[model samples]
Target: MKASATIAVARCGERDVVIDQRCSAPFSVRQCDGRILLASSAAAPVGGDELELTVDVGAGALVSVGSVAASMVWPGVGGESSSMTTTCAVGDAAHLDLSLEPTISLARSRHRTTTLVRLGSDATCRVLEETVLGRRDEVSGRLDLSLRVERDGRPILHHDERFGPDVPGAWSSVSVGAGRHVVSAVLVGIDPGPPEVCVEADRSAAWLPVAADAAVAMAVGPDRPSTMNMLAALHPALVRTAPVSKPRA
Candidate 1:
């Protein structure tokens, strides 16, 4: 299923905002917590399900995009799989925050997610992500995640994580989920809150709350040697733009 949402800031006055929005088939939204929740449900198949979601926030706007409920990845029907691709755009000094809830993959169901972000040099954006391998019961299978960041059409950073059956206690390990439902957040732009605040969150992961001259990125999951190295080698500019230094716990 393909779905899109666009918000344009006409004016910002006194903590009030004016927005313009549009959506396509299989994508819908509901109001909650002074924000809008976007959602999509698609037909599942064996190879998997594919959901492409896009959002654009015009200049000088503050917007947040998230789901009303935890996203689900069902087992592929007839040998099919499921995946999602999300793209976001943020303009100058504009704040676009996507506070995503947890994503769960059922037994035998394989899933992947790719996020692409584009932002103006002065734009500020904060992204959040959480993927939980199995819920209360029926645990198994691998979940792959891929992320890419770009600015001015140039690739910045990329990450991929895979978790599942072959892994030992795959979903509960410190390198994987740390026995807790994992959650991740990325904040970028000229002014990204205070340094202390970012450090607190990064302590939850590894490197974080860094500066980005133009862009920033991150990825998490059961480690695959190549994937982690590749994410680190994403681009010198990307790593330099955002200083993500980590002190081993």
Candidate 2:
């Protein structure tokens, strides 16, 4: 199945409002608590499925986008790979934050995801992404990820990576090592100044400056929590809301 979604936000007086929104099955979008949320209506992006999302932020507007839950990829009947692409446009003086839950690639499944960001003069944005190899005690399937960012038609960053048992060089000591989860973040509005690198027994992280006002941070670890923790320490989000921990029974 194929699904497409679009969202447009514009600044009106003192507040930013959603001017337009279009949703399809398995891709539901809604506004809540002054932000936009993407929710899955059904099991989606199964092998052979294609999904696309587009976002536009009007000049001077400040907006944020997030997902409700993690996405799961399953094998398709024809064994073809599932793919998802996201395109975003930020207008002059506008700001956007795209932070979504992790995506899990199940055993025997194949998936690919790509994100492209275009910014006008003085526009800024923050994007966060997370991925998990597979469920606990199960082998992971093949997965590919790509990210591209441009400001005023000038390239700012272009990165790509592949993972899984089938991908050669992914398991080497110099590659992912014993990592099964990854987290990456990009900040395009502020200058991180310098580069920083950290390595531990189960994880490694790096913060690299890319442009005068942009930087990228990445981390890989044995699990999701460690990876996210590492990236959080390197490139802290402007506004982050952590999940509430349950009390012991």
Candidate 3:
């Protein structure tokens, strides 16, 4: 199956959120106040599924986006692979909160994902990405993930990761370790606080300052619940309570 989804939000006179434009196929989008929820209406992604998504935040707009449930990538059939690409643009002083559900890669599956974000000078953003290697007692398939972020036309972050079969020594890499689940969060245009690290029974989490206005948090856990707990503990340190106001030109 192939699908595409798009959403654009603009700020009205004062605090109203205007959905300038929206389109979706196979994937459904619902708007509530300033928050948007996405759900898949079509069958779960299989071997050769493809998906595309785009989001735009108009100047001064505040919006949050989330998914209803986790996505599962089943093994490819007939050597077909799956892929997804997403792009986002945040206008000046706009605030975007993207809390995506986890993705599980089943055995023998092959999938690729890419994300690109462009932010205005004063824009603020919070993004989360999580992945689970495989189901109980099963080895994961293959996955290639890439993320890029730009601020005022200049690059701020560029990251790429590959996991699963075919990548030599990938399973034992220090970055991923032997954990079953991994979660990463990025915060932009937010004040940085002191760095903190926490270790629990089945998870390890850390909040690191990337820059004065940027921060990143990551967690690796034996299971989904433990990983989510770690993420919750680190969220307050990375997420800003209020959006930053745009400055006069």
Candidate 4:
């Protein structure tokens, strides 16, 4: 029962879009101004859920992170198991896009996510992640995931995934989020220019911020496809939500 939240968002957009933020939580955290809205799905809380978050972006402020639902990680029916943690800080010519979506671990869940970024040497960032696996829909059990990413403090990227089935690489096809279900990654900010940014960094779905900076980990299973490219799997608050998704109902 260690719930937590700390947010500091200030860009107040004209084009810099941070929208708005100011939150402190013990429980009861539903946000506005772009989003952060998830109050729990299956609804049951006596003393087994934990959420910790800390976000700060000020120096050239620009932040966009939206999520209010699609956070389902439940699995502790008297055997006890529940957890969550997130951290972020961005300054220096600041611009941050943290839209970490898709997290579902029904059944018997245990989740962990840790991220740290401190770049003052021309600071700029783009961090997007995704994870989905819990039996396409017809619930089962077992889910464990851990992730960490850091820069300037070094720890480029770290990983873990265990959706069960003896969990030893959980069915390795040569690494990371193996046997897939749907796992994604993207990390940017690095453009020292020259030679068309190293030939557009060999064209691995270009998410051009300055030049070409990349970190792409892929997993999809069944012949393991998804070499990630749709403009380097574009993330920057998903290009501002693709122009408001004006499709039909």
TM-score of each: 0.67, 0.93, 0.88, 0.32
List candidate 2 stretches off by more than 4 Å: 238-249
lDDT per residue for candidate 4 within 54-135, as digits (tens), equals 6776666656554655566666657466666667777676656666546665555555545555544355666565655564
lDDT of 1 by residue, 1-249 (tens): 434555444324434243555666456665556565776644332234566767666666666667777776778666466777788877766666676667776788877777877877666666656676677655745677776665556655566667777665564433454332444445565443322211122222233435544334344433223323433343332222221211110
CA displacement after TM-score superposition, residue 205 of candidate 4 (Å): 19
Q: List the residue pairs that clash in candidate 3.
A: none
Candidates 1 and 2 compared: the better one by TM-score is: 2
Rank the candidate models, highest TM-score first.
Answer: 2, 3, 1, 4
Give lDDT tens digits, candidate 2, residues 1-249: 999999998877776777889989899997666567899998988999999999998898887888889999898888899998999999999887888789898988889999998999999888888888888877788889998889999888888988788788866665577777877778888968789898998789899898889998888898877677777777665336431221110
Q: What lDDT is obtained when candidate 4 is compared to the true structure?
A: 0.49
Which is the leading candidate under TM-score? 2
Q: What is residue 176's positional error in candidate 3, in angstroms? A: 1.0
lDDT of 3 by residue, 122-218 (tens): 9978877888989898888898888777889887677788888678777664557778898777788777687879876657888887878987787
Sum up the clashes in candidate 2.
0
Give the backbone clash total of model 1: 13
RMSD of each: 10.0, 5.1, 4.0, 14.8
